[model samples]
Target: MRYDTFLDEVLVKVKTYLAEDGTLASSRDSKSLAKTSDLKLPLEGSDLSSILVDIDDYLQKCVKTNHPNFMNPLWGGLNIAALAGEIIATLTNTSMYTFELAPLASLIERSILERMCEMVGFSNGGGTLTTGGSNGNMLGMLCARSRGEPLSQRRGIDGTKLAVYVSAESHYSVEMSANVLGIGLDNVIKVGCDDDGRMRPDKLVEEIERSIAEGQRPICVIATSGTTVRGAFDPLVELSEICHKNEIWLHVDAAWGGSCLFSIEHAKLMAGVELADSVCWDAHKLMGVPLICSAFLIKDLSLLRKVCSHGDAAHYLFHDETESDDLGRLSLQCGRRNDALKLFFAWRERGDSGWAKMVDGYMELAGHLESLVVEDPQLELMSSRQWTNVCFRFKAEEEEDASELNTEIRERLMQKGNYMISRSNIGEDVILRPVIANPGVTKESLEGLVAEVIAHGEDARRGIPSA
Candidate 1:
C-alpha cells in the first residue's frame, strides 16, 4: 500500500472510532483473546496492507476510553488539541534532556511547570514533567529525603531511622516511594483519617511524637488531595502547620484533585497547599491531557536539582554555556518525551476559565449522580462525595451477600460492555466507583449508568447468571 493511502485509511479509522457509540471494551477473556490474536513474530516483514489489518484488529478489541461510559479510571476522554500536539511531538522525535536538542519543548515544559507552581502557591518554584503520578510521588519523596539529610546524597544514611507519614487511605505509591528511597515500608507510618477520610491533624501529631520518642526522625509527611476509592482531600492547612512545627518536609499528592485549583469555588478544597515543600499534580487526570503528563513541583527548585543531581559525566550532551537551559539537570530522566506540548496545547485551547468551567461542570454531574443514588431504594452511597468519584453499591436483601452480589453485578456490567466503572471497597463493604474525569460523561450518561447498575442489581438478586 502507498504511504498516503495508509495514512488516509488510518485517519478514517480514527474518525470512525471517535464517532462510535459502542461498548467500552470487548468481553473476551485473556485466554480467549490471546488464542484468537496473531501472536507469531515472523522473521519476514509484512506489507503495509497487512499492518493496516493488524491495526484494525487491535482497535476493535481495545477499550474505548473516550466513550461516555468509560468512568473506570482517574482519566478518560480525548482532547483534540492535545492529541494534535502528541502527534506533532511524535513526528518530530526529540529527547528533552538538553536545550540544544529540544529547545522549544524545554521552554514549553518550563512554562507549564511554572504555571502549575503558581497555582499551588509556590512562588519562584519549579518542577519537571514526570512519567506519571507514581513517578511524581517518588520524586517528591526523594526531595524530602534529600532535605532531611542533605549529605545523604553523597553518603547514604540509615533509612531505618528516617520516618515518613501518610494517610492510611493514601495511594500505594507512598509505600513504593519509601521502598525505593531505602526507607523501609515499616518506617512509613500510616496516619489515621477521619470519618470523611481526611487525615486527622491530632492523630498526625501523635504519630510524629511517637516516632520522635522512639528515636526515629520524621523526615516528611505526604498528604493526599484526592484519594483513590473515596476521592477524599486531606486537610492541608493543619498538616502543613504540623510539618512546619516539626521541621519536616510536606509533599501534597494532588494528582487526582489538583485541577480543583482551576476553580475559585473548588480550590478551597486544597487550602494551605502553598505552605507545602513540594507537590505532584497530574495534568493527565482532571486536566484531560494525554497519559504521562504529570508535574512534580517543589517550593525549593535548588533542592529538587540537588536531589536529581549527577556529577558531570556526559560531556557530549552538557556544555557550560547551555547548562542553565538544560532540563535534564533537574530531572531523573534522560531521554524524556515531550509530554508538555500536549498539556500546553490543551491549556492554550481551554484557558483558566475554560478549565474552571470543566471542573464545575463535573462537580455538578457528580452531584446529580449522587442524588440519583440517594433517590434509589436499592442503592446506597458508600461514602461522602468530595470530588467526582461516586462510591455506591447495590443494597442487598436480608439473605443476600452484599459484596458477592455487587461483585457479580460489576462482572455483568463488564460482560455487557456498555458501561465501565470500577469495583472498590470501603473498609469491608464493596462499592462501585465511577469517577467523572472523562469529558465524554454527561448528566444523561450518568443517569443511564445508574439505571444499568440497578438493572444489574435486580438480576443478581434474582440469582440470574450473567450471559
Candidate 2:
C-alpha cells in the first residue's frame, strides 16, 4: 500500500475505535494472549499491508480507556485538540532541551508553566514539565535538601540525620523520593490522619518535635492535596503554618486533585495552597490531558535552578546568548520530549471556565455514585466522598466473608469485560474504587455499575463461579 493510503486506513481505524461501544478490554489472561499473539521477529521486514494487520490485532486487544465503563484508573477518555498536539509534536521530532532546536515549543511550555504557577498563587514562580508526579516529588525533596544543607549539592550530607514528613495516606512516591534522596525509610516519618483520612496537623507537629528530639533534622514536610485511595486533602493551611514555624520546606503533592483550583466551589478544598514552598500537579489526571504531563512549581525559581545546576560540562549545548531561554538548565533531564504541547492544546480548548465545568461535573457524578452506594442495603460506603473517587464494597450476610465476596465480584466484572473499576483496600476491608475522572462517565453509567456490583455480589454469595 502507498504511504498516504496507509495513513488513511489508520485514520479510519481511529474513528471506528472512538465511536464503538465495545467491551472495555479482552478477558484473556497475559499468558493466553502471549501464546495467541504474533510474536515472531524475522530478519525480513514486513510490508505496509502486513503492518495494518498487526495494528488491527493490537487495537482489538487493548483496553478501551475512552469507553464509559473504564473507571479503573485516575485518567480516561480522549481530548481531540490534545491528541492533535501529540501527533504534531511527534511529527516535528524536536528535542525540548534548547530554544535553538524547539523555539516555539519552549515558549509554549514556559507560558503553560507560568499560568499554572499563577493559579497556584506563585508570583514570579516557575517550573518544568517532568516525567510524572514521582519525579516532581523527588525534585521537591531535592530542593528541600539543598535549602537545608546548601553545600549538600556538592558535598553529600548524612541522610540518616535528615528527615522528611508525610501523611499516612500520602502517595507511595513520597517514600520513593526518600529512598532516591538517600534519606532512609526509617527517617521518613508518616504523620497520622484523622477519621476523614486527612493528615492531622497536631500529629505532624508531634512528629516534627519527636524527630528534633531524636537528633534528626527535619528538612521538609510533604503534604498531600489529594490522596490516592481515599482522595482526601490534607489541611494545607495548618500544615503550612507548622512548616513555617519549624523552618522546613513545604511541598504539596497535588498530582491527583490540583485541577480543583479551576473550580471556585472545589478550590476551597486545597485552601492556603499558596503558602507551600513547592508543588507538583498532574494535568493528565483531573484535567484529562495525556499521561506524563505533570508540573513541579516552586515559589522560588532560583532554588530550583540551583538544585538542578550542573557545572558547565556540556559547553556544546549551553551558550551565553541562549542560556536564559534553554529549558535544560532548569531540568534534571538533558533531552526531554515536547510534553507541553498536548497540555497547552487541552488548556486552550477548555479555558479555566471549561476546566471548572469539567471538575464540577465529575464531582456531581461522584456524589450520585455515593448516594447509590449509601441507599443500597447490600452496599457500604467505605470512606467519605471528597473528590471524584467513590470507595465502596458489597456487603453479604454474616455467613459469607465480605472481603472475599467483594474480591470475587471485582474478578467477575473483569472476566465479563463489561466494566473496569479498581479493587483496593481501606484498612482491613476490600473496597471497589470507581473514580469519575472520565468525561464519558454519566449518571446512567454509575447506576449500571452499582447494579452490576449487587448482581455479582449475589452470585458470589450463592457459590456461583464467575462467567
Candidate 3:
C-alpha cells in the first residue's frame, strides 16, 4: 500500500487503542476474550494492514497494566514525558556506539548517569544506560570481574575460579551474570538471610571465608538492595564493610528498590549504597520510566572505561570524540539504543521534588497495606514494611489449617481470575505477596484486592474453587 495510507492507518489504530484504555480494566471482558491456544504466524509475506489487525487483537486481549486496576508487576501507569521520549527514540533509531551516530543521546545519557550516581551518593562516578535490570546486573558483574582479573578478559578464565556472593533471597540474574561471565554457578555463594529475609552480614563474611578456604578466589560481593522474592534489602552498610575490608568488589543490585533513593524515608533502607564499587538500577521499575531504561553505574568512571574499552578502533562513527559525544567506551553493548532519553525526560518532567513526592506517595500506600494486613485478624504479616512489597497470608479461622488453606486460596484466586498476587514460601508457610510498586494503585484498589482474597478463600473453604 502507499505510505500515506499506512500512516493514516497507524494514526487511526493508535487513536482507537487510546479510546479503549478506560475499559481495559474490565476483567470480565478480558477473560472471555483471552485465547489459550497458540497464536498463528504468517508463513508467507502479509500486508501491513493484515499484521496490524492481528497485533491490535492481541494487544486488546492482553492485560493493560497502564490501567488503574492493572497492578501486576513493579511498574505501572504511564508518564507522558517518557512516552514522548519513546516516540522520538524510535524515530531517531540512533545507536550510542559512537559520537557521530548519537551525539545528543550520549550527552543526555551522561547527564542521566551522573544524576543517578549522585542519587546513590556516588560523588565521582559514571555509568551507561542498559537494556534492563538483567543487563544492568550483567554489566555490574562484568566490571567487577574485570577489575579483579584484568588479564581474564584477554586470556579468559582458564582455571581460576572467582566467586561472587549474594543472599539466598537475591535475584536469579546474579547467577545468570556469573554464567555469562564464564564463572560457573557453583562459584556464586548464596548466603543465609535473617528472620526478616535480610541478608545476614555475619553469614556473608563466613561464606567468603569458606569460599577462600575451599581454594576459591572471592572477587565480588553482590548486595541486593531489593530482592525479587521478598523485596528484602541486604544490610548494605555491614556488607559493604565486609566487602571493602576483604578487597571484594561491592555491587548493589538495586534494580527494584533503587527508586527509594528518591524518598527520604525509604532511602534509608539502602544505607551505605555509596560504599559500593558499582550499582545497578532500573528506571522502569520504581522510577516509572518506560521499559528498557536501566543503568549500570560505577563508583569510579575510569573503571567502567577500563572494563569495556575497545580502544584504537578508528571508525567514522567514533572518530570525532572531542567534537562529538560518545558513550560506547563504558558500555557492554556496541550498538546501544537511546534508553536514556526516556529516563532523562522522566526526570526532567518531574523534577526532583515531583519524583520524590511520587516515591513517598507509593511508600504511603504500602504503609496503608501493611496496616490493612495488621488489622485483619485473618491476615498475618510475614515481612515488615521495608520498601513497598507486603508479604502476608489469610489465616485459618482458628489455626486448624491456616497455612495450607491460605496457600490453596492463593492458587485458586489466580486460577479463578478474581485477582493476582505473587506467592512466596517463607519459613515453611506460603504467603501472599502484594507488591505495591505501581503508582496507579490506590487505597480503594488495595481494599478491593483484600476483599477478593477473602471472597476467594471463602469459596475455597466451600470446596468450590474459582473457575
The total of clashing pairs for model 2 equals 0
TM-score of each: 0.98, 0.98, 0.90
Per-residue alpha-carbon lDDT of model 3 for 257-303, expressed as tens digits? 89888877678889999999889999898877878788888888877
Model 3 lDDT at residue 402? 72
**Residue-level lDDT tens digits of model 1 in 343-455:** 98999999999999999999999999999999999899999999999999999999889999899999999999989999998889888999999999998999999999999
**Model 2 residue 54 distance off true place after TM-score fit, in angstroms:** 1.2
Off by over 4 Å in 1: none
Those runs of model 2 whose alpha carbons end farther than 4 Å from true positions after fitting are none
Tens digits of per-residue lDDT, candidate 2, 1-467, equal: 89999999999998999899987898459899998899899799978989889989998999999999989889999988889889899999988888999999999999999999999999989999999998999999999999999989898888999999999988989899989888878888999999878999999989999999999999999999889899999999999999999999999999999999999999999999999999999988988887879999999999998987782467888787888899988999988999999999998999999999999999999999999999999899999989999999998787878889889999999998989999998888888999988999999999999999999998888878887
RMSD of each: 1.0, 1.0, 3.1
lDDT of each: 0.92, 0.92, 0.80
Off by over 4 Å in 3: 1-52, 158-160, 311-317, 320-324, 397-404, 415-418
**Is candidate 1 or 3 superior in lDDT?**
1
